[model samples]
Target chain A: MEQLLQQLVNGITVGSVYALVALGYTMVYGILRLINFAHGEMFMLGSYFALTLIVSTRVGVLQLVPNVLLGLLLVFLFSMGLVSTVGVVVERVAYRPLRRSTRLAPIVSALGASLFIQNAVMLTYGTQYQVFPEGLLPTTVWRVFGVEVTLMRVIVLAISLGLMAALYAFVQKTPLGTAIRATALDHDAARLMGIDVDRIILTVFLIGPALGAAGGIMVGLYYRQINFTMGWTYGLKAFTAAIMGGIGNIPGAMVGGLLLGILETLGAGYISTGWKDAFAFVILIAILILRPTGLLGERVAEKT
Target chain B: MSRSRGIALFLLAIMIVGVGGCAQPKAEEKKPAAPAEPIKIGVQGPISGQWAFEGEGIARAVNLVAEQVNEKGGVLGRKIQVIQGDDKSDPKESALVAQKMVAEKVIAVVGSYASSLTEPASAIYDEAGIVHITPSSTATKLTTKGYKRFFRTCFLDDRQGLFAAEYFSKKGYKNLAVIHDNTTYAKGLAEWTKKYLEERGVKVVFFDAITPGEKDFTPTLTKVKAANPDAIYFTGYFPEGGLLCKQAKELKIQALFSGGNAVNNPEFVKIAGLDAAKGAIVTTEPLPGDLPYPEAKQFMEDYKKKYGDYPKSIWVILAADAMRLIVTAMEKTGSAEPAKIAEYLHTQVKDFPGISGPIIGFDEKGDRLGTIHKAYVVDDRGEFVPAP
Candidate 1:
């Protein structure tokens, strides 16, 4: 039972990152209806950027703060903001050109962009895996029901959940988010209503990529390591989560990410961990077979 | 009806045919006349991607050896030329590279760092009648596959696992938790150590195999801490192993963590941070810095001079030695032919002074007759200090 609880904690922490990153996938799909395959590389670049900044600047200023929490907050904000800017630029250059081309064009362009970014990083930073600087996250353990919950788990869970809530509020409350939803539902109608669909699409890319960047930074901090190839498996899993949660459904992405994470963790503990990856995809298959639209997902008429 | 013109035309045609025949023989004669053509050797490995640095290290060492041999007035009065190809660490790609090397008619082929890439690729080289040697492939199945043409310079995972287990027992650690990457190398080492440690009454408290390339390992660390093991044994490559060490530290697991040669990479220390990597132990094939042999020191100097970076793995030295072994066997047999070289290798390598250790194999199975593990600890500065 303790093992079960620990696994649950593990699942939630990782699943939260997946949910956040998957949210980006869902949002981009929701608005532009493009897969944005380069989204994973965007996340990778975010981690790299955060790693460079935190290690070079904030980590050296340790004498200023007797407490470590303040140092971490600064690192998170600086990294997140930088990654958000990167997201906007990538969308403008890579996706904007293919917006009017054939459907296959954007898909191919996204893949090319993904490869280009991954290889560029590989060449510049080298193929060596890098670890994040230590002591930025807390390590204290709290015992609950004979299971130990470390501070890293708590932080990852809180940040992920916190980000999800913020996103929810933004989508439901903010004028910009309303424009995004309106454009997503009916781009032509939204444009006729002076919604500026292109601006909304750009905003979606910005938000989605920023979330992906946050997830990437969180992963590097949580795992304490980053590499050029680190984005592939996580990216694939997040994509699966987005689809399992009904591709374009925001809340569905959240549920799918958490469920996939929990299922994967439990499967690792109870069944063979060797098959854990297989288990993540099994949920995707099951979700596709059952409701098809996923929990909270509503099927909409196809646009001609 | 112009008989004189017909006779002149026939004589001209005969003259043209005679010149063409003379030119063809001239080409064939040049081949035999230049019997001093350099003895061609092929080197293959991942010169790109994640393992590119290691591959380039091997290539540099091989070129250094070639330069040394050529300076000494060539091998058997013939210069040695090294041809290189990149495998990119993919099995199918490795096999294709091996085929290309074989087509190039290289006397011996050296390379491929990983076991997964080497196993399939070695079979291709063996089938193509090329003598293939690996610098650092540690899979148990590689030598066991009965590929007479395939050989490796490093000890396999079982030997590495036993060395770690023995060190743990010697250090008086009773409770142990092992986490493996579920790869052929990692899983094999972990299983071997588990069996060996349990036999000696060391409590095997936790055993888990994690997926490779995953970013989060909080769940695994949580399990390891809950089990309260004395030490954490990880048998995986640097990429994941480094992260595991950092995560373990972040979780305050505080147990001794050790891994196999895969974690010997300095990148592990850099990635895990010096604090997280401190006190971590890893068993690796001997690095150049750890070499006590005079020949090894010379080889190290040559490698550093040529590559301008410290040799990445002891495998690079082995790769150089494999080239030496092939050349030595060729010299011993006094022939450049593959059949003669293989026959001579079985007899000549008994006392061959390899850079890693003495290259003494009893049979073709490739167990180095006098090689043992060199345990290393990651210091606070991230340098692998040889564990006394």
Candidate 2:
């Protein structure tokens, strides 16, 4: 029972990051109707950016920083800000130009962008796995409800859930959120309704990557290591979560990500860890066969 | 019209004959005046991926040996030219690289570091009638495939596994949990280790396989925790190895953590953090620093000077030794031909001293005659020091 509880904590902590990255995939799919395959690279770049800021500041300007927590926050904000710009630039350069072309064009462009970013980082930072600086975060393990949990795990879970909630409120309460929802409903109709559809699309891109970057930072802190190719694994999982939750559904992505994470953890814990990845795909296939629209996805009439 | 066409054909033949006559003397003149064409030695490995550091170490060591040979007025009056083929650590890529090396007309190839990469690439080399030497690939099946040309400097999986099992059992860590990445090398090592451990009357409390490149191992570690073992043995590369150590420590698992040679790297310590990595044991060949050989000490210093870091792992020494062995075979045979060099290596080389250790040439199955492994523990200084 304790082991089950421990696995649950592990699952939720990992699930939150997947949920964060899934938001990026679902949001972009919602607004642009493009998969934005390069969104994962933005997450990778965020971690690298955070690594650079933290390492440089710790070495050069440690005295100016009041505490490690404040320094971490500053690095997090800077990395997210930088990755948001990267997301917008990727959209403008890779996707915007092919907006009216064949649907294949933008998807292919997204893939090309992903490869370009991966190679660029490889050429610049090298291909070796880099160790994220340790001791920045507390390493204490807490006994919570008869389960052992590290401070980092608790922090990752709390921050990720908190960010998701904040994003939910922003999308539901703000005028920009309404514009985003309207665009997702019908792009042409949203444009006719005097919404800056392009601007709204760009805003979604910005928000999604920012959230993804936050996930990246959390992963780096949690794992204490990062590699260029890490984006592929996490991205694939997040993309799967989005598809499983309903590709363009916001709240559904959150539910899907957490469910996938918990299922994978439990599968690894109980069944066979070798087939942990296989479980995620099996669930995806079962969900697709059972309900093509996903569990939380609403059936919509196709406009031919 | 027929007379004119005959005259044009005769004129073209005369022009071709004139060009051939001029090229013959020029080629002859260039051959004698210039040094013998450099022998092309191919180096294939993952130059860009998770294993890039190991590949770089191999490449650098090969280059270092070549530089030393060339500086001493070349090998057999011909400079050694190292042709690099970056396999990117994939089996398909490894085969492509092997084909490229064959096309490049290399007499002998140095690497394809990981066992999964080497197994396929070695097939290509064997079919192409080229000698292939691996510095780090340790899968037992690599030699058993009847590939006469394939040779490796590292110990086989069985040997490493037996050594680890003996060491742990003698240390009284009877209940153990074994984990692997499910790759050719990792699974082979894990299986052999488990078999030997069971034979020694040690109880394997838990055994599992994890996917490579999966960053998180908490779920699996948590399961292992429930098994309540005295030690956890992970047979995989350093990336996951380090993460497992860190996560296992976080779970407050009191079991000692140990792994195979793949975890014998500085990156493991770096990723696992200093505190978490301490006392983490790895079974591998002794590093150059740990070896008492004077040549090993020199190699370490020269390597640091050249690469700005100590060798990433003992694999670098193995890589350098592979190059030296090939060169020695070439020199002894007085031929750079692949078959002749292989024959000389098999028949004549005996207990050849190398920076890594004394290599006893090849057995009938083309495996190294004898190989040994040493255990190292992560010290408080974040270095892999010889375990007491």
DockQ of each: 0.47, 0.66
The candidate 2 chain A region of ten consecutive residues with least summed lDDT is A59-68
- Indicate the DockQ of the complex predicted as candidate 1: 0.47
For model 2 chain B, the run of ten residues with the poorest summed lDDT: B20-29
Top model number, DockQ: 2
lDDT of 2 by residue, A154-207 (tens): 898989999999989989999989889998888889999999988997898889
lDDT of 1 by residue, B113-204 (tens): 88877876676666655677887786667788777667777777777777777888989999999889877768888998899898888888
Task: Mark the regions of model 1 whose C-alpha exceeds 4 Å error after superposition.
Answer: A55-59, A62-79, A93-105, A137-146, A192-194, B1-152, B169-176, B191-208, B224-229, B252-255, B292-313, B316-355, B358-360, B365-367
> Against the true structure, candidate 1 has what lDDT?
0.79
Every candidate's lDDT: 0.79, 0.86
TM-score of 2: 0.79
Q: What share of the true interface contacts does each candidate keep?
A: 0.58, 0.86
Q: How many steric overlaps does candidate 2 have?
A: 0
